[model samples]
Target: MKTVAFVPIKLNSQRLPHKNILPFGDKPLCWHVINELINVKQIDEVYVYCSDEKIINYIPKEAKFLKRNPNLDGDLVKGFDIYKSFIDTVGADIYVLAHTTSPFLKSSTISSALLKMIESNYDSAFSAKKVQTFAWFDNKPINYDLNDIPRTQDIEPIYVETSGFFMFKQDVFTKHQRRIGFNPYIQEIDEYEAVDIDTKEDYEFALKLIKTLNENGREQHV
Candidate 1:
């Protein structure tokens, strides 16, 4: 199947202005994910979908530029709309919806997710962090009972979806108009890989982490 990856970027960020273009190590923030996608052998092509043409200067030569309607750049615009727009514009059996915010996400994990999703019976797959601590929801304990409390390690784990990537077959989206299908595959990643830069503090931490990695001569895959 023809698999394609795309990172939907908007120049104006509400939390952190022009965050996609901000300096992250040796390259812009968005450049990291684009570069990782390009290196993934499972992905046939990588594209940077943005309303602004300025992104063309930041992306690598291998990554294509996909011009999207500016109207879709609204703060209230749903991700489903953007997914549909991209699917309609580009033809592919499988579509990879990646996020520039997840700069540290590895290409090997992406390739593994794609291969696992295609090989397994699940219809879609995405990355998430497994929280195995005492959890609560609606003011009630989720994995523990008030009368009988279990050890944190023995508690049921809850999965929190991260801004890493969403892999789904074209038909999965066409059928449900959603990124996740009936039965979804969840890939667990470490805290370092789950770092998503959505706020100013996150950006600062990511920048520091990038510098630390460079100082130690560690690759992005780590």
Candidate 2:
């Protein structure tokens, strides 16, 4: 299918300043995602959405870049907004929203998600991890309490949101203006593969994980 990967990023970070440019393994964190997306044969185009001229300049000249406006560059703007703008501008058959922080996510992971969406006729799909913990809210235990019998597997599982990737049918996004449209599919990703870096700690952890994978000879190349 004609799929375009739109990766939204910004130089003005809150928790970890310029975390996208930070070194991870041998290259910048953004390179990992870029390489994977670019290598994926199913993807038609790879677009890096950002406003920072310096960041945009640093991106590989080989890959296509879409310079975001200053209004879309601010921290207040939600990721969905940036994604919607790209859809409106490009109008691809399939739009994949990927995060630069998720360097560990393989091209296969992305391709599989999109394939599922296409095969099932899903409006949109996003990566997530199945959660089965004793959730709590307002200092009160939710889902299961001490009084209830412990049947962890039987409990209704919650899909923990992983901002790794999202696949949307271009027309659905144009009509709905949201990633999670009416008919959404949640692709369950492995806990180990769901690495989202929003802080310095998250960044360090991801690097360590990548290093460990490399040390174990499990590192993959695009």
Candidate 3:
């Protein structure tokens, strides 16, 4: 089956302004995930959907580039719209949605998720991180209560969508109008790989983590 990976990027970020082009490791932040996608053997093609021409220079020649619609450039624009636009314009049997913020995501993880989704006949698969800690909602206890608090280890794990990556068939998106389908598989990833840079502190933390990983000769895992 033909698979295409899409990395949606915009120059303007509300929390961290111009974060996509920020210096990260050896190159721009977005390049980290972009390059990772290019290395995925399961992906037949990689594309960057962005409004900024400045990013064109950084994108590798092997990946295709498509300019996003101006109307959809605003921060308030819904992500579903952008995704649907891409599906309509650039057709593919399977689509992989990868985020630039998830710089630590490994190519192996991407390949593994795709393999599982295809082999298991799952409609969709998304990268997530498992959390076993107590949770709360609206002042009420969730996953735990004061009356009978379960040990952290014994607590049922809750998977939090890390937005690291999403693999889905074109029909899944057509039916749900979302990246996730009715029957979706949660592909758990390590905490390090789930790091998403959305703020200044997150960016700094990622940089430090990258430095530490490199110093320990573990950069290849990224």
Off by over 4 Å in 1: 215-222
Among these predictions, the greatest TM-score belongs to: 1
TM-score of 2: 0.88
**Alpha-carbon error at 138 in model 3, in Å?**
2.1
What's the TM-score of every candidate structure? 0.95, 0.88, 0.94
How accurate locally is residue 86 in candidate 3, as Cα lDDT from 0 to 100? 86
lDDT winner, 1 or 2: 1
How do these models rank on lDDT, best leading?
1, 3, 2
**lDDT assessment of candidate 1:** 0.89
Estimate every model's Cα lDDT from 0 to 1.
0.89, 0.79, 0.88
Off by over 4 Å in 3: none
State the lDDT of candidate 3 residue by residue for 76-113, as single tens digits.
Answer: 89999999988899888899999999988999888888
Error at 148, model 1, angstroms: 1.7
RMSD of 3: 1.5
Q: Clashing residue pairs in candidate 3, if any?
A: none
